[model samples]
Target: MFRAKNLWIIHLLGWVLFMSLPLTIVSREPDANFPMLVLKSGWFWSFFLVYAVLFYGNLLVLTPKLYLKQHYAAYAAVFVGLLILIYVSQPFEKLIFRKFRQEQGREARPEMPRGGFRNGPPPGLPPGEEPRPMPERGRAVDFVSLTLFIVAWAVAMAIRISREWRQSERRAILSEAEKAHAELSFFKAQINPHFLFNTLNNIYALAVSSSAHTAPSILKLSQMMRYITEEATEHYVPLEDELACLENYVELQKLRLNAKTKLDFNVQGQPDGVKIAPLILMTFVENAFKYGVSNHRESVIRIAVEVTGSHIQFFCQNRIIERREDVERTGVGILNTQKRLDLLYSGSYDLDIRNAEEVFTVNLKLSGR
Candidate 1:
């Protein structure tokens, strides 16, 4: 967007260039007295003023109010009317020039010698021949005036159309950004409730069993909730903060695990200066716990995260002990996360999922800014 001051500066510079065009043409003439020509030629000054008015009128009013609004007949009528007005008014300059020439002739007559002929042939002319009358310059002047008028009209139209195109492009970009922001917020809202529902269920099981780990599980839930409400509300959070939240969630899930279930969680790398989209990795961990744990049979779930500078690699694998009845309903979290990834990471991240008969696996890679 151009600031008001800058826009005015552009307009001023454009008009300066427009006004200099006449000076440029005049400078090419032999023995041209530029200042005198400009001062004596009232028609040239009037021409400049008329075209200046026409340029602004077309730009500020005619184009926007008539041509752009599809008032084709009215715009054409107005254009023809202006042309007729110009043609009719131009002869007044000829009259003014003729009067000026007569006055100069009258002033010079008294200075001639008493016996000298007033209308004699020039010295270079043949003795019996008369000098040819100078050709009328009106046709050339009219041609130049018409050309200027057309140029003024074209320049106005071009500037207005170009500005309108730029503004339209900017508006489209802003609207798309706003829409993406709204979608990301909606997806985050859905994720929060879904995550809370599962965590509360885990805490409930511990409470009903009267297990000694119930208090610690509740404390972990409190910390995770605090992180969600505070740090996770932003589009991105520090990698260490997200890892701490995930660790709390994992510990809470461990309270319900029996000796028959074995889980391994590992993380390697310093997380300084690294950040990621919040809660993007939690859904995979939640799925591993939901269907991979068994009370009476051997079960194993593995989760690993490796961070190197601005790049992160995550892996999760689990044995599927319980089969899902409604595939669509069970895949909601995954779908939601995928949408967020598309919006946030776009082409900067990769995700792969494998669902085998006996095992489920997820591999994700992220490149952070």
Candidate 2:
């Protein structure tokens, strides 16, 4: 399909509309020599031709090459020279028209009156007598030409500068998108390795102990890996899919937990039609299992997910049984998750992490897609 290259197509159409004004003049003055008025009128077509050339040339060439490129002195000098030429050329063009008329033995037409053309005689002219012709008005023509020149210059500059600004903004958006993609890729690389190392260690411990849960743990791990590989890499996934992956991870982690560990995982609402950033809530859940479980004490890890319309809330509260030094070691995952949230959701989500006394909690709220 054909598409417009840019806004220049619209700009060209506007100029064509303006150029058709000569035809309007021809229609209003049917008895006038329309071709001679348009083609031979020194201040009309000459002014339009010069204005058109200056408009496009200045915007398309001089602006990008000189003005936009910071060749301020050269750009100003060239424009000043062009203006001087235009000013001088106006009078010379009028003189050429007069000479042409004289050579053809045609009397110079009277200038339009100050208030513009009137079909009847002036107030002072007697009835049935023709009014004396007005003399050529150089100042009026010059003023009109100058006004047109200024308007064309202003409009061209405005359009060109606006286009350049939009282009710059578009480029900036593309650059930011690329940068965010690279950063997200780097984050995924960090997360996958760290998570795999921990999961593999748990599987190894289970296999070495000749535990009956080893095969089930491996099956759950396979499902978790599939989720991570296929769905987590995507920008968004169905909320149900993410919740299922979380369930698999929680089940796999349960295989290695001590008997005293109390874990409650609950989903409070339907996830139908809801979508969210994949694995966004998993890091908090993982941290709860890592630092909340204890062999000697009653340890509790609570995870809850609530969905209402397109709103989602995730809550994780864990009894912190590890020492302060060990707890600090778990910051990597949470920090990475926070950065991802900031990049992806920015102002659209809220994440609060609190640690008071022996309890650590994560509360996250989001407007899901």
Candidate 3:
């Protein structure tokens, strides 16, 4: 509202300056008689009143009604007609001034030098051509009017076009933001159900055996579920909070792994003030545990996270168990993670996966906004 008010104030001041030009500088003369000067000034003010009406009428009314509605030909025609009316009215305006001077002459002297104010068109003009010479005062007024008409029309069009462009850009930004929010919500919904199904299977195995680690495992699972349900719904969570959730998940998975199976997880640097998308790192870690561990043979799985002021890097590596089923299931989580990365971070992140020599390694890097 304040911006709108400021615009109106500027417009009013500009028109006020245009109206005051004739009284101040355009009509002022040092040597002219007092009555003649008044007569000359009247002619300028009369022309100015009509010119101002036509200029503002086009800007505020005709431009919006016709030009904005795509009626370009009609808009041009209307303005041309207005210009023609202004040009034709000039002679009648000069006739009014001539008559006033003649009346003053009857009361004052027998003959008063009229100077350059001509009763008719200049001599030696070709057919259908405009008069070459005019009264000094009338010529100055004509020049000012023509220049002002062109300038005012150009300025009004420029301001209107700029305002429309800004409004269109704002609408596009709002639409894109809404679309991203909806897509992120849908992706997160997929992640939670898939993860919970796998975690529940692990807990079922522990309950069937009546293992000592079953109670602790359930407690850890409860904490991780709370994190997923509460914190994961948000767009960003503190890096420290996300790391803590990762720790809980790894601890829960340890119950299913034998002593011979190595599951090492480490953090390298401080994660005090950093923020990240919640649960973004879990897919790779889950994939590592699912296919990288075996009860019969010794298996090694390693996960590491490094943090700096500007970026965070994550690494997960696991020896692939020689099983077709395990290999196929691992690809599902990794593919979903790639989709999420594209949707959320796009150009601000990097992910590399190596699946060769019976070993799988996943590396991810995320830069801060």
Candidate 4:
């Protein structure tokens, strides 16, 4: 089916579109010398048809060797042969004209065979009756056509290779960028575990000191430390994993400040399959435990998460009950998280932080993968 379609289109569009200039001139020239007009047009058309057939085949046959194998001499030989055949057709033109006329009523216009025209001269020419000038010089026509073919072939090949090279370079650069981002995250992880280890050690000190609430604190620290070290070591974790880690950290803080600290953090959403950066939630949780939980005054921290479709919202609010005399600002957690969001989310996430009156709050909206 494809071959048949190609054949039909080539006859219609290819001949009519590309060869229209010459075909139109021959068909519609207004000069009226009936037999002479047919004679000249027939001879030239026959010669041109043969030249086109050979020239197209020459391109397919020679271009691969010239570019891929760099066979310069083979390219030259092909051009020489093509020039010879095209020039020689000028001499055959008169003969072809005579033969085509003889066959108009002698036989039906020869059925076109495969590649191109299929008719050749029949057997009725005696020994010594040929035209005087047998078309000696066709160098100008031959050179013009051959040079155009070479130029077009070279341009097409260069464009193809250059496009492929640019695509490969773009892919390599993107891969290197991704690797560097992963390494930076690893550096950040190192800092995270250091903080977790110190908190665990503090819990251990409380236990070995045999404080009255040591057992519950030890268990809380165990769960929180497991979550910090184990769950936050991935590119993306489930939303539930992050929430669980946050709750565990808050519980440990509650154990340490036994009945003096309160936390109100909750989540109600699709808890599985939604993906997020593993440690993004921890900075807010850590900040709440550090500065908001007061043992002797009114202190409360509230956190809520809502997820729908590919969007997620995390809201955190904590009272600045233990604000130091000279301290009037948020801490390193929010700053580092701001930088991380700039690096990882860019235009894809929104963050708001406010410290008004005695209350501090953070609201984050992020996209899930």
Using lDDT as the measure, the top candidate is 1
lDDT of 1 by residue, 216-241 (tens): 88898999999999999888999998
Every model's TM-score: 0.82, 0.80, 0.72, 0.55
Question: Residues 233-255, candidate 2, lDDT per residue (tens digit)?
Answer: 98789999999988988887888
- Tens-digit lDDT track for model 4 on 1-369? 345347557435544443444334334435465435454655646655654565445445555547446787877786677566545544332334345446444343544443432343334645555423323443344343344344444544554455457778989999877975776475466448645765786677777888776777677667766766676666677777777767766666666664766778788788678888777877776676667877687787888889887689998888887567323233544666677677667799999989899888989999986
Q: What lDDT does model 2 reach?
A: 0.78
Candidate 3 per-residue lDDT, tens place, 1-369, comes to: 348658878878877776555335423336457434554555555655666676677767888788888999998998778666556555233533444445446233333234522565446656576544433343424444455566666777666767767788989999988988887887778778878888889999999999888898888889888889889898888888889989988988887788879987999888988888887899888888878889888889999999988599999999988777745545755676787788779899999999899899989999743
Minimum summed lDDT over a 10-residue window in model 4 is located at 131-140
TM-score of 1: 0.82
- The lDDT for every candidate, in the order shown, is 0.81, 0.78, 0.75, 0.63
Off by over 4 Å in 4: 1-145, 176-180, 212-220, 223-230, 258-261, 295-297, 308-310, 321-332, 342-346
TM-score of 2: 0.80
Q: Quote the RMSD, in angstroms, for model 4.
A: 11.5
- Model 4, position 101, has a per-residue lDDT of 43
- Model 1 clashes, total count: 0
Q: Where is model 2 more than 4 Å wrong at Cα?
A: 1-9, 16-47, 91-106, 109-141, 324-329
